[model samples]
Target chain A: MFYLLDLLGTLAFAISGVLTAMNKKMDPFGVFVIAFVTAVGGGTLRDVLIGRTPVGWMLDLNYVYTIIASFILAVIFRKKLEKLRKSLFLFDTIGLGVFTLIGLEKGLDTNLHPIICIALGTMTACFGGVIRDILCNDIPVIFRKEVYATICILGGTVFFALLELNLPINIVYLLTPAVIIIARLLAVYYKLSLPSLERK
Target chain B: MFYLLDLLGTLAFAISGVLTAMNKKMDPFGVFVIAFVTAVGGGTLRDVLIGRTPVGWMLDLNYVYTIIASFILAVIFRKKLEKLRKSLFLFDTIGLGVFTLIGLEKGLDTNLHPIICIALGTMTACFGGVIRDILCNDIPVIFRKEVYATICILGGTVFFALLELNLPINIVYLLTPAVIIIARLLAVYYKLSLPSLERK
Candidate 1:
């Protein structure tokens, strides 16, 4: 079930990447590369930083296949996708929850500090979009926009707190994403955003 | 001597990062982060991909010290740095040569394919500036500009070819960077650049 969610997240992220690249008017090759990077760049960076050899996508053909499929579908349905923006956003939020959990789990396995684990989770969930925006020559939306990473950090905090309460691991896993998904939905629904910091 | 060259490269990269961030009018904290990333970003990425735990800088205080020192010096000497641009460019080129060699050596240590090793070399020598550009909201100059990565690729090819000729390891190291440095210098002197690819 968890693995399925991971794949879904990859698919959603890839489609979003394709949309961004298409907007940039990049060639097909550039679009594909952006899609691949947006889908897996975060997990790849996390794996590398934690000394996980061979990286994730290189070891698993599923990610590559999923990205390729997402690219083709997104390109073919670029027009229709406009009407499906709400659905796409939901999938992206789901991805945020799942990827953050995966990163947190990996950090725990490696015996990292909770703060570091939270940071890892945030990076895993948000960095793919950061890379995508960078490739398209834009300041990353996360650094300036909505409380996206803030939700991940909150979810991670709740995750660790649940663990401390001696809750069942299954329940912890179930509730963490629930918190993240709902919190993100609320944030977006209410038009919440972080204020920009500037020196006067 | 190699270690010293590595530090020198770190220093040069950090200074360059500082200049770029200052141009972007980033805050002091932002400037320091950019400088740090530009100094160690390539090596950190290389180390992560290769599964080197604790990373290069984490295990070595010298790198951190070098970057911090470089940041301070660059900030204080910003006005005078314009006059030292030629010297700074020389150092940056030297960094490119040394960093490429370090990455190549690491890849060989891990028994990766020659092609992958060359990629590792290029990434090590060029990716810091790429990250810097991304953070500064610009397309990576390496992806568009002169024969920067091209020089690294050529240097890596020469390195393996020399190794195949049964040359001494010391001679190989010495010649590899020499090839990269001289090639880069000549390329810049001749105003050589890669042509942009455009889809009609």
Candidate 2:
């Protein structure tokens, strides 16, 4: 089930990249590169940090095949997608929850400090999007004291805390994404923001 | 003396980044970020790979300050820069030479295999420019079989070979850049290029 979520998340992210490149009128080659980067950039960084060899996509050709498939799908359905923006949002939101959990799990498996795990989770959820925006030459929306990464950090914390409380494993798994999606949705709808500290 | 070379390299790289942002017509804040990233991105990757704590720029506020100063200088001279096409290229070459040496030295300090050190050197010399292009939404020239990174790898190999031959330290330092510059000039003049694998 978790692996399926991971694959879905990769697909959604690749389509997001394809959409952005299409908006920019990029060539097919450029669109493919952006889609690949958006889907795998964060995991590659996580693997590099953990000293995992050959990177995630390099080891699992499925990830590569999925991104390519999604890019082709995006191209064919370009006009149809305009009416499905809301559905695309659903996929993106789910991807955020799944990737965050995967990141936190990987960090725990490596026996890293819990704080670092939370950081990794937040990065896994957001950095690919950030890289996409950066490449698109815009100010990253998540950087401006937004509730973006904070949502993932808080959600990961809730997951581990519940596990310590001896919550049922099945309950914990279900609750994790539920909590994150609700938080993120609220943050986006009402512009819930983190306060910035004044530089002195 | 070694510290001076390092400083010169940092300055040159920071300037190249500033120039890139200028070409994009970015504001002062954007220029500062581009400059900082170009100056330290490669070394930060190297340190992270080696598990070094507090990558060099984070440890030294001076590097950060230097980038800021360079950005200010770039802004003041933006008009002059706009009139000159080759200013960025000149600094980029110097930056590559200095980065190659620093990367080679750092790898030697860690006692990595010679071939790995050469890889490190080429990565250090070229990766920053690759990143700058990516952020600017240009195709990464490195992935295109350009002569750019190859020059750094060739010169790096020469550095180690000369060291083993017991050449004078000054001669080694001077000879490395000369080789890189001459090779780069020849390649550019002759329109040398790696054959691109035919696109499928």
Q: Could you say which candidate leads in TM-score?
A: 1
What lDDT does each candidate get? 0.88, 0.77
lDDT for each residue of candidate 2 in A87-172, tens digit (9 for 90 to 100): 77777788888888888877788776665676567778877876778767765545444566778878989988988999998888
Candidate 1 clashes between residue pairs 3 or more apart in a chain or in different chains = none
The first chain of model 1 has a TM-score of 0.98
TM-score of 2: 0.57
Model 2 chain A, poorest ten-residue lDDT window?
A191-200
TM-score of chain A of 2: 0.90
Inter-residue clash pairs, candidate 2: none
lDDT of 1 by residue, A1-200 (tens): 98999999999999989888777766555576579889988888888778788677755678888998998888778878889998889889899999999899999999999999999999888899898887889878889886999999999999999999999999999999889999999998999998888898
RMSD of 1: 6.7
Poorest lDDT segment (10 consecutive residues) of candidate 1 chain B: B191-200
